[model samples]
Target: MNKKKLPLKVLKALEPFVGMQGELFTIEHPGNNLLLVKDKDPNSKFYYTIEKHQIRDGKDIYSVIFAPKNDKEVGAYSTTIGADDITTTFNSWVLFLENYSKVKSFFDDPILESYQAEFFSNFEFVDEHAETNPFQTAEILQLDYLLEHVSTRLIELSDENNREANEVIVAEIAFIRESLTNRSQKWVVEQISNIYAKIAKQGVPFIKEFWAEGKKELIKIGIKALIESAQNLIS
Candidate 1:
């Protein structure tokens, strides 16, 4: 399929969320007139696609579909807005970028969240099995390195004087380590869901503060670590 580069206007609109680093993600035309936007972050493994469709009223609309790269069973999260032409399609994308957080929350809905919980629970089993599987030795080592790196970055993000945030971070890291070590699927699933809910409800905004203050590098490190660990286990 011939790939299409992002339009200048679309890039400008996505700048606030993706930063000025244009090379950090991949943009392609995935054929059938769809534009695929994928994050280059190995940990993220998320992508968005924009397409145009016709409705019963003979009107055209532009829609954006966001989903994780590896998930095949779960349906993609999508939204559509009225658009008369390609320019309007870009405009619709801009509007979506403006309300990105709300769109993200939709993808982070309860059903998908539960799926994530179950995935992580299974991941714990993989971790345990790695101990006896010589073929998985390298991957296990990489997972350990990534988790340690992430833990250090998270600690740096936390303030020693801020008891509350520190407590959350500590609990989160502890749970991560525990889940990696334990084989209790039910408990692991619950813990994963609880931690995810907490982060969604509180962590994003909290981390945004650091991002606003030019702490994006540190934040990226922490996020990368988490993403790498997840990818490693899932792979």
Candidate 2:
């Protein structure tokens, strides 16, 4: 982290939501040379960061980053436009944070999706308990992390106004969690389908694309199976 004092305007821009006191979970002003804000629930290491770069033509060029899970999006960064001036960077970041859940692209991994589709499309569904797991150790581990994030995000993103929908989704996730801990997971895909259906109907768009209409391949790789099938894919 660089040590420097931000101009008064920049300071004023960040004054409103500077900590855990706002709509976004929490933010920390580690130093004036850069501003640091975290993604919701402080869950993922992927951060919404803005920092100054030492290249200036007419204005200071700052590199802005808002990559979730450290997987950068296609148009995820407009660093040159926003970060050239701290105030602009701050404002754009606030919008991204506030609307984080609504935006699906932030979490979409095109390369992974392509791989997931291509790899698993014709793949066999072996007994997940067998040692011959079809996923690499790292990919399998990521599934665990992805499961945790998905569970937390589902609860947080549930529609409070739609009490029934919210409660139903909550209950569904709880059951799914229980299945993960226990050995009985034959119904994992079914449960996820139920959750997906509710989300689609309500238009609460967090993980809908995650389990989108035609991504049956990913659905077949049941979360429960991911747990039992924990060996290298290439073995």
Candidate 3:
């Protein structure tokens, strides 16, 4: 049996509601026992939980919890998924929603506003002569990293005669990829669908006609997710 890979999509989908303080449990991927948690800080003080255990029917049920770091708040939520849920995208999204909903406390609290200030303060040194401001710096660095990632894999797909034009698409993909990750998944999926719609208008023969472009979008979406997941550590 193959161990389930950590659901990157689920992680991203839950970001808005859960923030960086949570964990994920799975029985299908190599990293089945994935835990997404945050370090202790004044502003955002909680460790998200993702735990998996077996049910009476011999199915895996995942439970999500959020516990305050310095306080005595212990909240719990759980959901059980059957084999069918593990086999389809629908189940994946449902599972994500369950995990996300468990951490909704972060969203409901008015104190998060105060934490947001401390959140920025913790990274104050990054602003002090950091050579790159957050916007310009994160954008270029992320784009460059994205370009390198997609180029290595997609350049082989480009026609040798059209390498120049292909390079332009390559650059554009890098620019827009991060946009997907920085915002919401619904936004990113819509963006991806929209770009494909435009490419379809051009009568591109195949999905590969827009493959490189779509990938750029995906990379941006992926990286932003990764950063968001790890934000608690930085804070």
lDDT per residue as tens, model 3, 1-235: 1224444544443333432222232111213433344322213333444554345565445554434311233343345544344334333433444554466564453343333333233222223423212234454455446445555544665577656655655564554565533433332223323333333333345344445443455356444432432243223
lDDT of 3: 0.40
TM-score of candidate 2 on Cα atoms, chains taken together: 0.30
Clash count (model 1, backbone only): 2
**Lowest lDDT 10-residue stretch of candidate 3:** 21-30
Better of 1 and 3 by lDDT: 1
| Cα lDDT of model 1 by residue, 1-235, tens digit | 3223644444443343332222234453346645666554323545666664435376555576765312243235677755434445443444443444335553455654554454354333433433322223343344335445445655666565545755665566565554444323233334444444343344555434322322233234343333443444334
Model 2, runs deviating above 4 Å: 1-20, 31-33, 53-55, 68-78, 82-235
Best by lDDT: 2
How far is 64's C-alpha from truth in model 2 (Å)? 1.7
Q: In model 1, which regions exceed 4 Å deviation?
A: 1-135, 160-162, 178-196, 203-235
